[model samples]
Target chain A: MIHKRITKRKIIDKLVFFLSSLSVIIAMIPLAGVLIFVASKGLSAINLEFLISLPKPPDEIGGGIGNAIQGTLILIGLASMIGIPIGVLAGIYLAEYGDNRFGSLVRFMADVLSGVPSIIMGLFVYVAVVLTTRSFSALSGGIALGIIMIPIITRTTEESVKLVPNSIREASMALGIRRWKTILFIVLSTAKSGIITGIMLSIARIAGETAPLLFTAFGSDVWATGLNKPISALPLIIYRYAISPYANWQAQAWGAAFILVSFVLLLNIGVRYISRERYKK
Target chain B: MPHSFFLFRKIKLKKIKRILSGDFIFKNITLIFALFVLSLAILVFYELYSRSQLSINKFGLGFLFGREWDPVQGIFGALPFIYGTVTSSIIALMIAVPISLGIAIYLSELAPGYLRSPLSFMVELLAAVPSVVYGLWGLFVMVPWIRDYLQPFLESILGFLPFFQGPKFGIGMLAGGIILAIMIIPTISAVSREVMLAVPNAQREAAFAIGATRWEMIRVSVFKYAKTGIIGAILLGLGRALGETMAVIMVIGNRPNISLSLFEPAYTMSGVIASEYVEATQELYLSALIEIGLLLFIITLLMNIFARLLVWRMMKIFRGAKE
Candidate 1:
């Protein structure tokens, strides 16, 4: 009876392990399926015309989202300007002077900010900025995106700053250099690749975000000329076109999705390459 | 002698100011940025509450429990959305936990070193895919697949139950749950894997020495030690599922209903806010939507704070173990 029980226990353990392995396979289906399906459907729609012209009417066979691409770049630039300075500076504070209770509070707030859904941030911006401005604009969207970017960039900056060895600081201090100068010139330069990687990741995240842009930027079909005007974006075009019934619009949505995914993926890999080369040393 | 002494004192004052200025300026600037993050949180809550006060005053405490949600007649209640968000997140939790645990185990214990990082990156990629893309996929591929096959299969297996009695509408609570599961699996699995990795090697070796099987070692020793971290990961995942908007809105059929049937169409708190906030014409309707945003903000804030506490404690434990 004892022998039988032990053997049975072993068998049960084996079964559980097999089940765990099976679940991993099941988890991969959506991950791989979404990418593959989007690629296959979106590839045929991509051409030069798809890259450099205005969106066509629903029935038109082919049109491009050139304006949306330019708008996306401009919006990204606007978001970077708002997010990076405060985020990096706050990160420096965390790394350098954040051993106190105030540091922990900021850390907690950063996590909370990350958890706030992207759409709600848009609504927050709508209440705070859009209402005052009396209209949707690229400025509102960028502000919303900038808020989302802050905690992410801040955390990454903190981690990378922390990773720089304490010996560097000690060495600088021994040379009679001031603390702030050492941090700003030596430590930050040493961690530049990592910091840039963090920024790149932040950009990639906001680039694909659609919910925050829905009401804030309030998509336009034409090129957005000024900061106060509504801007077209790649994700918005994909969303609007995908929801439409027209075949051409749907095709363009696919094409745009392809481009968007490709852009984010290439950016991730390229940034990783730059960072990893430094990490290897 | 008096004039020379006064000039010397002025020179000393200027030199002190110059010496302290650079370092002091940098610290204060960064400190201001850090303070801004704290104020940002307070400002969000303040704005949400201040903006939603009109609805709060009109509805009193009844806004939460009231069922009617009519824009035409200026009636608003958040009950359906609350019910929908909680139930869908529960469904997602049920579906995601097992799969996430599995992936975590595979990463931490089963996978060979050669295949580990690549597989981990692939799982994280699921997170990187935009939520809208997931919505599109759910609408075009997953929903139809469910309507034609998965729903029918579930109905046949459990049709006697009330929860399974509804017709397959393709996009509803179950679909929302599935999409949420897909989105949240990465956060849970990634964190859980880190937790598992932080499990000490001595525990594993000791279990082996006692003649425990591989699974037995993982279950009785490794996982037991890392329980808090795993729970933290699940809570973080729950927090995410609750706040998810776009995919839920796209595939949840946008109906306001409280039903036991997962196949029935429903609306979520965030979903309703996302779908209707822009089109709201009445001031009351707009305020009501802001109230929902406030509730979402409060709920997510509480959950995240609790989750972060658990994670923070787990990190302490790991640090102690390492030392």
Candidate 2:
């Protein structure tokens, strides 16, 4: 009877193991399906004309997203300008002198800010920037994206800066370096790779954000006139085209998605590579 | 020689003064930036509250319970949205929780060491796929498949149930729920896997020492130990499902209606805001959309804080145990 019980337990264990493995397989189907479908459909839609020319009217075929591409670049540049300095400095404060209640409050708030939905960020910017400025501009969209990047960059920066060995700071201080100097010259350099990785990841994240850009950027079909004008972005274009009734627009949507996904994925992989290299040292 | 020594001392003193000023300036500047980060959440809340004032005054507390949402008539209510958000999120959790748990278990317990890192990376990649991309896929691919096959199959098998009784429009609560499930699986499994890994090896060893099978050991030790954290992970996933906008908007048919059947069209808080905010021409209409956003913001904020606390507490317990 004991022998039979042992066999029964063994069979149960095997069954549970099989079920768990099967769950992983089931979970993977969507990921694989999405990647494959985007690539296959998107590759055919992309070409020289698709890259260089402007989008055709909705009823027409053979238009490109060149203006959208330029808009995306402009918006990302503006966002980086706004997000990087503020995020890095805040992160520095948290890492170097943030052992008190106020510091913890800031950290917690950053977490809360990160958890706020991207769409809400759009709304907040709309109220603050768009309503006041009285137009949907690339500036407003960049601000929205910039705010979303702040918390992610802050958290990652703090974590990576914390990972820098205290001994390095001590060594700098021993040389009569100012505390700020030690942090700026020694600690930050030591954590440079991780901090860069964080920034890249945040960029990847905001690059594909669609909701926040909906009202803020407002999206234009023509070439962007100025930072003060409505600008097209890859995500906004994809969302617009995907929902429209035209088959050609839907096809263009896939192409934009392919480019966006490729850029984000490559950045993520680059982050992984950089972090691995850091660990190797 | 004395004059040269005095000059050198004077230069050293000036350099010290500069360093002190630099440190002071740097510290305060960074502090200002840090304060900006701290005040962001409060600012968002303030902005949302102040902007939604029109609706707040107009609807009062009854807004959440009122079901009508006609913009032309200026009769706004949030009940259908709240209903859709809750029901769709509940459906997502129901389907996602088990599969996520299984994946977490496999990753933490059963997977060979060589296979673990790559598998984990692949799961993370699932999350890295953009929301819009997912929406595009759901629109073109998943929705059609659902309309033709999955909904029909479910209706055939479970047609007696209220949820399965309606016509299969494919773009409804069920489709939204399934899409949400796929999106949140990565989050739940990743967190649960971390929590399970934090369960001390001693618990497992003790279970094995009693001649318990591997599955039994996992059930008695790992699951029992990491239960709170797993719940927290599930809540985190729920929080994500609640606020998901684009994909659900694409597939949920964007109709503001309340129904028991999952096959009928529905609208979520985020979905309504995304679909209608730009088009809202009237002051009250705009304010109503902002109010929905406010509700979504508060719910997600509370959910995230609570879930983070649970996960943090659980990790702390494990860390203390290790010490």
Candidate 3:
């Protein structure tokens, strides 16, 4: 007997689901609050000069973020130099040559490493690199960030390479290609797009990292020159500016936030674009 | 000439076999390299152990139970930091978990298809925002809001409870916990949403075929199947919360006090390390910090292992059952 039943359980269920979804929406408050506040106050200052000027003193009401922009680019470049090749190679080994116990172990380790907190990695770098050097520097920060990037790239590379079909590998082998040559010439070419997405995501992950850079790179308010000295980056600059007593500094902090957010969002979009391109072909 | 050609053919076959064996060797070498990734864990543990040995020897196990940290006279205890870490993380999870679960359920079972992806992506974007940014927002906005409104309101009502006592600083454990909750919500929501989405539609349909309503069907089918996955997600968020540094340090008002009051200033393992790892001068002081690092590492490591096992076991069970 099928009855049209509006049961108590049904009412409770709907209520619970509604509450849950509403709370999720509620959780967005802090982020939305921050973004709107920053945009209104920070948007007006996002001029060419703000982008170009080095941080002036607290009294200097308007200044640009030239040093910060330059430092971030250099750090990203150094991090990629250290991280991408090693991660790609490691991933290649796992995907192509990894059919054994060691491969499984490596894959597991990479996952575990990926789960490790970025702060711990920074601490590790500090103890191993920074303390020994006896000073904070961008190289140290880049290395710390690179440590965080490696596992991300490795896992993405492995997964991307694994996605390439065995048929392709077999075809290369049938042509009498050596195994390594088959992997390099055929497998990597197929997996390059996904690998690029992984790299971009890794870049995004490191770009927002503040903890690792805190003790390692050590922020500079002034323009930075070499690897040995402390450098100004957007995140560090934001932290400094946000915490200061001055109102103008606080406004500048919001501008820096806009810059950092834009970079991360662009990286996210870039990954999406690369992945779409791969699928289209 | 025929005999010589046969000999050459034999050599060629042997060479091919050797090349195949070399390929096998190369494969094994890759596996070895993968295994080397674990060596990082080993390396971290070893470095922390040796570096922290002095503190361990000096304080013995009592250091963990000890309640004071006096850097001047070399007397140190980690009880307060330990307490701060556990309490704040627990508080953050308590606040974040329910809200995150609600979000996951809403996105998976309630939201329209077009809205799900964008909505979920927006939530994950919160995770993408740097901790330092959160720190800035918390210090400038949240802290002030708490001091101005939330703390006063909470204190008047919960005044009997010590956790709400003392004048509001806008930068104490309560504010820290609230900030941490904001940070962890996206993590839990993201993972739990994936798990909830992984639940089979067939099971939901089966429940509905028995005249179950939408909510009842989800309760009977999806939630049951995804229980372990949800748990793992929560654990992962907990692990992240435990090791969070920059943001927590910025607003946690780092004083090593073991007050029951949530408004009191406190220091976490990570917060302490980030704040002081730079100027750690004395050997014992440095080792003390490393010991704290080691402790935090161990806690997070165990949490991660638990998360991995839960995920692995659930996946294995589900896949095997499907097969």
lDDT tens digits by residue: candidate 1, B1-323 = 99999999999999889767878888988999999987887888888899999999999889999899999998999999999999999999999999999999988898889878778877877888888888888888899998999899999999888877796988999999999999999999998999899888988999999998889899988889899989989988999999998777878888999889999999999888877877887889999999999999889888888888887888788789878
TM-score of chain B of each: 0.94, 0.92, 0.91
lDDT of 1 by residue, A1-281 (tens): 99998999889887877877777888889978888988998898889988999887886677799888988898899899999998999999998888899999998899878887887788889899998889999999999899988988888888889889999999999999988999999989988888888899988889999888987998887877899999999888888887788888887888888888888887777776887697789
DockQ each candidate and list the results.
0.71, 0.70, 0.56
Q: Provide candidate 2's TM-score on chain A.
A: 0.97
Steric clash pairs (candidate 2)? none
Clashes of each: 0, 0, 6
A-chain TM-score in candidate 1?
Answer: 0.95
lDDT of 2 by residue, B1-323 (tens): 99999999999999888766878789899999999998888899999999999999999999999999999899999999999999999999999999999999999999999988889888888888989999999989999999999989999999899989797778899999999999999999999999999999999999999988889999999999999999999988998899888888889988889999999999999999988987798999999999999999999999988888888789999999988
Off by over 4 Å in 3: A1-5, A276-281, B1-33
Scoring only the A-chain of each prediction against the true A-chain gives TM-scores of: 0.95, 0.97, 0.92
Say which prediction, candidate 1 or candidate 2, comes out ahead on lDDT: 2
Q: Which parts of model 2 are misplaced by more than 4 Å? A: B1-20
On DockQ, the leading prediction is 1
Q: Candidate 2 falls in which docking quality class?
A: medium
